[model samples]
Structures are given as structure tokens and as C-alpha cells.
Target: LTVGPPPTPIPNPQVVATDFLEVNREELQRWVRGEPGAFDWSPFIQHVCKIEGRGEPWQEKERRLRGRLRRILPIDVHCADPLGAPLRPPADALLSTFCLEAVSPDRAAFGRALLNVGSMLRPGGHALLLGALGESFYLAGAARLPVVPLDEDDVRGALSDAGFTIRDFRSYAMPPALRTAVDDVQGVFFVHAQKPLEG
Candidate 1:
């Protein structure tokens, strides 16, 4: 999902939501329409409320989120314009998870991909990125999908070179007990980085 860009210090703006997925998008629509057999987001809402610590009822939060979401679009990170049409004024923030590494063949490609995705986020806006660390491949059913093996330094340098200022960078090491032969992921990383404000 994305938030509209502004004249800086935009404390509030009309909240609209967008996500990438044709099938998932349809499923989300079904839920919004209160259709039976639609996937329920109750668990996720409850977890979010718990983490928010606001004691807000999950139903309220769910209703609020569902109401805000009006559009869902497919994303092609490699496209010069991810959404086909460039969003005017751009978006104030973008959230990406396990996307970069999956699409990139190597660190250089990863950097380029990040630059492409960052194009959507306006200056001074933040991008929250989550991805596996040092993972070369993963399984998609019987198919073994290949991915770029990334480390902390790679992500840090890419963000810097892409003109993003690192606000926070954290990594979680993979536990041996959970490590499987299907993938060689050593850990995972999360970064909150901001684009520089225009001069």
C-alpha cells in the first residue's frame, strides 16, 4: 500500500491503499464485499493492534483499513514505471518485502532494481525494505528459484548509492534449528531508509 506525497511534513493525507496481486487482489475484494469463503485478515489485524499498543479493537482497525483500501495494482519492479502510469506527486512511502533479492540475479541488479522501486517514493519519504540475507536460492514447490545472495554491506551500500539515508538497519540471524537444505539463507534484514529532501 502507498500514501500520497505532499509539500513536506505531511502529517496527514487521505489514506488510500494499493497492493500487487491479481488473485490476491480479487480475494481482498471478496473480503471487502463481505463475501463468504473470502480469506479473513482477522489474525493479522489482531496482531497489528497488539503491536500498536493502542488497545484499539481489531474490528475497528479492520474496518478502517478495509475502508481505506480502494485500489489494487500489479507491480513490475523491473518496469521503468512499476505501476505502468507514474503516480503523480508520487508516494510518500513504499513498503517492500523479500522482493529485491527474489527478482535480482546479483548485487548490481539488486541495486538497479532498488533504484527503480525507489523512483516511486518522493523525496524525504521512507522505504521499508525486508529481505533475506545471503540467500542464493529457494524452493517454490518443486521448482528451485534462484536469487541474489545479499549481505548487510550490500544492502547498506545500495541504499547509500541510491541516495537514501539509512535511518535504521537491523538483521536477524537464521537459527540452526530452523535452517533447511532447501535454502541457504543465513539471516534476514530490515531497513528503514529515507530519500534526501530536494534542495
Candidate 2:
């Protein structure tokens, strides 16, 4: 089952009403925000500072940016699978992208996981992702996960083998927490690939 605000948040995106799989709000928020994964650390750091100051109530205001991105792009969701395997969705599905993250510094596994996610999408579907390219740092719940950096070339090669056409592959910085200064992080590569309709 799949339903929520439409893939594209438009004039009247309505909350979908479906009864298939469970739609826990907590899980949805985690996926929407990419939590415990690619996230900002500034707020967390600030929160810790307050903890040290004791029981004083502090008003932390969240800013909501109002703007419009003038693009009618396809909406996508990525399931970080190691092997390029197909995932079955209900017929009413609206998402267009599935993905994996195989560019870990280990090189022990290539884009297998990411490829697995891509295999489930319909042809012409798109995806966006953050990959580690030549980066050697990461943190897992206070424990450090050793990472070795992989370059853009490596990412492309894996996606190609998984039957995806490279749409826009680039490098991007991980959230502050992923950086060594904030904690201990190494390096990473970013990519966006698609399954061609003509395939």
C-alpha cells in the first residue's frame, strides 16, 4: 500500500487513503527527512548545549522557508538495497525512483545495494542519492563505521551495470554530523540516475 501527500506537493496535495501496508507517522517522517542518515547536526549540537545549562525553558523556533521551485520533476523514493533487485509496489504507486548506496569506502560491495532498489522502478523513473566518493569517515550511533572513499567513476560503473542511465551524478557534502570536525567522517560521492523508458 502507498499513499500520502502526492509525490509532487502541488495546489491540492491530499493525504492519501489506502489500506495495504502500515503507514506509521514516525516511519514516514524518518523516511521523508532521511533521518538517522543524511541530516543536519547544528540543531543537535545546540540542543546539547542547553542540556548542560539545566532546567531553563528555551524557545527554539523552527523557520519555515516559503518559496517555489519551478520544476515539474518526477517524484522518487530510494530504498538502499545492496543488490539491484526489483521491489513490488501497488498499482496505484506514484513514486518513480528506487535506489541503493553501494559506494562505501570498503569497496567490498559495489553499487549492489543501490542497484537492487533501482530494479523495482518502472522504466523512465528517476532517483536522487548521496554516495561516498573518496571519503573515509562516518558515525553509527556513537560508533564509528570505517569508510573508504569511492570516486564518481565507480558509482557510474555500478549504476550502468544495474541497467540505469546516468542522469546527474555529482559530489555533495554530507550533513555537518558526517564531517570529522563535528564528529569523525571521511568522504563521500553523490549521484542521481534513472531507468530509461526505451529500455
The Cα error of candidate 2 at residue 128, in Å, is 0.8
Q: What is the TM-score of each candidate against the true structure?
A: 0.86, 0.47
Off by over 4 Å in 2: 1-105, 172-179, 182-188
Each candidate's clash count: 0, 23
Tens-digit per-residue lDDT, 106-142, candidate 1: 8998998888888888888889999999899999789
Looking at candidate 1, what is the lDDT of residue 143? 93
Let me know the TM-score candidate 2 reaches against the reference structure.
0.47
Model 2, span 52-170: residue lDDT tens: 78643332311111012111212222334312233333112222211123223344355554555565455766655565555455454876555545666767777787787766665
Scored by lDDT, model 2 comes in at 0.45
Worst 10 residues of 1 by lDDT: 10-19
